[model samples]
Target: MKIYNTLSGRKEEFAPADGKTVKMYVCGVTPYAPAHVGHAMSYTFFDAVRRYLEFLGYSVVHVQNFTDIDDKIIERAARAEVDPAKLAERYIAEFYDEMDSLNIRRASLYPRATEELPTIVDMIQGLIDKGYAYPANGDVYFRVRKKDGYGSLARRTLEGMLAGARIEPSSHKEHPMDFALWKGAKKGEPEWPSPWGPGRPGWHIECSAMCHHHLGETIDIHGGGQDLIFPHHENEIAQSESYTGAKPFVRFWMHNGLVQLGEEKMSKSLGILVTVKDALQKFSPDALRLFFLSSYYRSPLKFSEESVEAAERGAQRLRSAASIEGQGTGPDLDSDPYRRRFVEAMDDDFNTPQAIAALFDLARQVNRAFDEGRRFDEAQSTLRELAEVLGLTLRGLESGTQADIAPFVDLLVEMRGELRKAKQFELADSIRARLQALGVTVEDTAQGGRWRKG
Candidate 1:
């Protein structure tokens, strides 16, 4: 299979470091607040990477980390009058709820920064002992000058980085380019006892330590948002290789494109953000997932209500087609066109757009079979396998909601219709409010109102 390697800036054939076993690590969240659509776009991209590898019959071991102790966590905790650790825990639970609603597969190991303090401190001390890092006033900083080929990932020189001031000046560092390995404990912040003094791991060091601890010194894939390609991933390569003496810290580096809001990055600081919980209230979770898959993983995804609505319409078409060919018997093991098309698309750098197009192709065949009054067992099975590869569900292409909410929504819809026909606008609005309160949404259309589960 061909996968894009961010370090090389080219698509390369993928081969597991160990035979038939793939180990991957992607950066997780700091958990200060509710996750937004941008966060959804980030994790959803990596989840596709893991799912596709497993679909190829490789034993995949995926690990993601929780940055439980950070400045954001501490600051937010102080404002909320709760412990920083408790704040992290609450948001971590919310993260899982968001991921589960979107059908993300859980990672093999979900390591938290607090739980891996020993590993982090040991790694930091190794850097210090080897002369690659130094202690300055209870803080440890990596000596960027000591590591040769330091800017290979960012393709930058120390001179250029300094000129650009990407490497900001630090009074205590041996050089301005050097980054912190361990941060000194501050008032009202979490800390661990370390050789350098009681302190916390730097942002970059936490990821390197966590990745090495979970996936080893060398692993098949290391991935995160494209923003990490610079100081974050570059510094990771330097410290990890210097400590382990490994040639390459990660064999293949995969970076998903940035999530964009017009010309700007989506940010809570700017107030132009939508929370996952709120967005899911207006649209199906599958719609957002499909919107992400519609673009190549390595391309910028622009967010706007109109664009999201467009994605929703396209996803509805695909889901509608699959529902038409509900449950059926298995297909013949051979001569499965859907299987061939999907594998071919995935093999070519995980081109999901092509794979989705193939689904429509199969939808045509299923439609023809339905018109002929023929059993579509083969077509049905093909749709199931292919959709699984794409991490999508047809949800009974030809069926209705089977959950307990189905009956409740059906009753509410009838009541809403009667109230509307009576021209009791106030009563109809009240019924709609009641349905929404029950986590059921009612939508009015030319054909009248219909309700769906929240």
Candidate 2:
């Protein structure tokens, strides 16, 4: 398979270093707050990548890290008058829930920054011992000039980066372009006992250390959002290779484009984000996945309700086609061509848009065959299998048996009854109409309101 490599700035043939298991590491959240759709977009794409790799008969060992001890977590914890660790744990649990709702597969291991302090300290000391880093004023900074290919991943020279970069002026830093490996302890913040006094690992070093501690000195694939390319991932490359004496820290660098809201990217710092919970409340998990995968992984996607609603409709179409059970025994549909098209599209740097189009085309053929009284059970199975490769569970929002949805239907009916009692006839009628649209019919009797699946 050919996958895009940001390191090489082109698509290249993909193979594990060991020629067996694929060692993958995608950056995880900070756990300062609940995750947003931007997070969903990144993780969902990675999830699909993992699924497709498995489908291609490769075992993938994925390790994602949690930056639990971050400035944002500490600051937010102080505001809430709670311990930072407790706060981080709370949100980490919430993150799991949100990802689960989105049908994202769990990573093989999730290493937290707080739990990996020893490895961080050791790596920092190793960098300093090798003269690639220096300690100044109780903080450690990576010597940018010491690394020969400092900005190779970013495709820029040190001079070019320094020219346009926003260098934070510091007395302890030898150069303005130097980034912190460890920060000095400050009042009212968490600190770890490191070689450079009592301080915490910098934002970039935690990930570097985590990857080394968990995955190894080098991994097959390293992925994150494109926003992290400049200083975050670039520094990761410099320090990791410097510490481990490995030439390439990561074989493939995969970065998904940011999700935009209005003119600005949806970011935690900007407070411009739609939480995954809120989006799932309005749209199905399948719809959200489709919306993300409908766009190329390397291209930025604009957030819109209309787009996701349209994806929901598309998801329903696929679900309906897959659910059809053929009665006549004539000719089995030839699904091999569609499968080949899907595999071909995905093989070309994971072209999910074309792959999704193939699925839709196959769905149309499946429906046509069903209408022609031909046995379509095998074709339907193929549809479901291919959809699973993309992590698309061919199930609607209100999937499962009648018992599972009865509670929600009953609640809606009760709400409609209250609306009718309040003389809000319009809203009550709308709710009834919605229920009918979902194949659930409601009846009003002297006893109360009743609901049944049609």
Candidate 3:
């Protein structure tokens, strides 16, 4: 399989270092608030990538880190008059709900910054011991110039970066480009005992330390949103490479594009956001996954209710076709072509849009089978297998409005079945039509009278 490496600026063949397991690290959230749809989009994409890699026979050990202790979390906690750890835990639980709703696979390890203080402290000390970092007034900063080719990931020279970058005033740092490794804790803020006074790990260092401790000195792939390509990931590279004396801390760098509301990116800091909870309540999981996978991972995706509704309709088409049962009297159905097309598209930089198109094409073929009075069991199973790889759970062709009414629908379906057995064709047909009007579809296949909410 080929993947787009953000570091090399092109698509390259994927080869794990040990030729067996692929170690992947994707940056997680700060847990200051509930996760938004943008977070859903990124995590969903990575989940599919991981699934596809495993589908190709490589064991994937994925690690996603949580920034439980951050300036945002602390500041928000203070505003609400709550302990920062309590606030972080609340939001972290809320994030899990969102991820579970979106069907995101749990990472192999979810190391939190608050839980990795010792490792974070050791990493900072190692940087200082190597002369690549220095301590100043109970704070520590990494010397940016000490790392050669610092801006290679972002593809900008030091002078260019200085012109465009926002230089925050820091009295301890010798240069504006130098970033913090540890910040001295204040009286109210959470702190850990460290060599450089009481302090907490910086945002960038927490990830480096967590990934190194969990995955090893170097990993196969490191992924995050495109917005992190700059100072955040660049700083991670600076510290991780310098601390380990490894030339390339990560072999493959993967980044997904931002999800947009209008012209601006959907971010909590921007104050314009759509929470994942809102989306999950309004749309099905298949619909949300379809909405994001409709576009390439590296391209910015626009958010709209209309778009999600359209995706829902599209997903309904696939589900409806998948629900068809073959009569055993039609022509033979083959799914090999569809499977081949899906793999071909996915192998090229994990092209989900094209892969979904292959699914649609199979759905169309399955529908054609029903029209030709042919059996489509093979096609239906194939559709399920391919969609499973994308982490999309195809809902029952008939999705009911409420879970509490399943028994009631089953009673109605059973009554209709008896009516048909008594040779009451017209009355039974009327019953079927009434059920269909109520969003329940009853199909009397050779197997039995199967019914589901549509």
Ranked candidates, highest TM-score first: 3, 2, 1
Ranking by lDDT: 2, 3, 1
Question: For model 3, how does the per-residue alpha-carbon lDDT over 96-117 read when each residue is reduced to its tens digit?
Answer: 8889878889999899999999
* Leading candidate by TM-score: 3
Off by over 4 Å in 3: 397-404, 413-451
Give the TM-score of each candidate. 0.86, 0.90, 0.93
* TM-score between model 1 and native: 0.86
How many clashing residue pairs appear in each of the predictions shown? 4, 0, 3
For candidate 2, give the lDDT of residue 247.
72
Which candidate leads in lDDT?
A: 2
Measured with C-alpha atoms, the lDDT of residue 108 in candidate 2 is 95
Error of 1 at 190 (Å): 1.9
Error of 1 at 142 (Å): 0.2
lDDT at residue 350 of model 1 (Cα atoms): 84
lDDT of 1 by residue, 1-454 (tens): 9998988989999979887999898889989988888889888878887888988889899999998988888888999999999999999999999898787889999999888899989898899889999999889999999999999888889888878855556789889888888899987578888877888988888888888888899989998888888989999999999999997899999888877888877776576778889887776767788888888888888887787788777776666556553333333223277778878888888888788778767876776565555667667678766777777765522223554556667877888798889898899899899878966668785557765544
